[model samples]
Target: MYNLLLKEVRLGVNPFFFVLPLITGALMLVPGWLYFIVPLYFCMITIPNIFGGYKSQNDLMFTSMLPVNKKNVVQAKVLLIVLLEVLHVVTAMIYGKISLSLYPHLHYIFFKPTPGFWGLTLVMLALFNLFFISMYFKTAYKYGAATLVASTVAVLFAVEAEWLGIQNQFVSDLFKGSGSTDGLTHYSILFTGVLIFAAFTFIAYRIAYQRFKKVEV
Candidate 1:
């Protein structure tokens, strides 16, 4: 499992992707900007390009021939995806903290980079994984449709969440107003998002594993 995961990190994924989080995370430094786009970059750019690499390299066929079961192949691949997603979010959160300190008095028109906001980001990516993983392993090679559908769902969620932060007074207070700074409220939201993320990703993995078992490759 470790070696397969290493193969994913070393040979399967490009070196550039490792640096991408830093570039995208820097966007958090932009004062009072719509910060959701920071994590969305993973869904938009990272997943497609990385999975495209897998397809072009014939990763499914190559790995299947290496004496490993379909389960480990799927597990390593999914683990790599989760790792990248977490890296993106954690780096962005650091930048988010810096952004807050940089402009302590800045008024945000969009959701602030609070724990609750990061929580929502986790849920957004969870939804992406649920759609993308389950659909991708239908063939375990072609990823275009999976990436398209999943990314669309993620974007829609971000849009709706942001809209709620704007249009709904309670949500506004919770995410942007005084409630934003309340540790209990924001942390609770973050915790719930974490649970949802774990559950959704696990479900995605199970579904993808079952689908991949039937694939000829």
Candidate 2:
């Protein structure tokens, strides 16, 4: 299992992806931008490229030649995906803090780059992985439909949330309003979102494992 994971790190994922967080996370520094879309773009660009490389490399066929089983292959790949997602979120958070420092009084038409906002980003990514990874691993080749459906759902979540934030003052205040008392509630929502993302990834891995087991190569 360790060897397979190393293979995934060394060969499965592109070296370019390692630095992509730095690139995409910079978007958080853009003042008054829709910050939620930074992580979404990370998913949109990286995931498809990762799987596209897999198909072009005939990675499934090549990996099947090795000693590892399908479950471990799936597990290692999913683990890599999770790691990348974490990288994206953490880097974006740092830039978000910098954004706050630079523009302390900036008003937002959409959600602020708060911990709660990242919590919501995690939920969006969870929906994306629930659809993208599970469906992509079903064949280990085709990812277009999976990517489209997953990306659409994630994008729509952000767009609609922004719409709600704009149209509803309560929602806007909930996301962007200043309230010292609501910090606890904000963190609680963040924690719950993390838990939900973990659950979703677990289920996605299990389903992908079973699905990949049946693929010929």
Where does candidate 2 stray beyond 4 Å? none
TM-score of each: 0.99, 0.95
Q: Tens digits of per-residue lDDT for model 1 on 110-188? A: 9999999999999999999999999999999999999999999999999999999899999988888887889998899
Tell me the RMSD of model 2 versus the true structure.
Answer: 1.3
Q: State each model's CA lDDT, in order.
A: 0.94, 0.86
Q: Superposing all C-alpha atoms, what RMSD in Å does each candidate have to the true structure?
A: 0.7, 1.3
The positional error of residue 60 in candidate 2, measured at the CA in angstroms, is 0.5
Q: Which stretches of candidate 1 lie over 4 Å from their true place?
A: none
**CA shift of 3, model 1, Å:** 0.9
Residues 14-66, model 2: lDDT tens digits: 89898989999999888889888899876689988988898899887888999
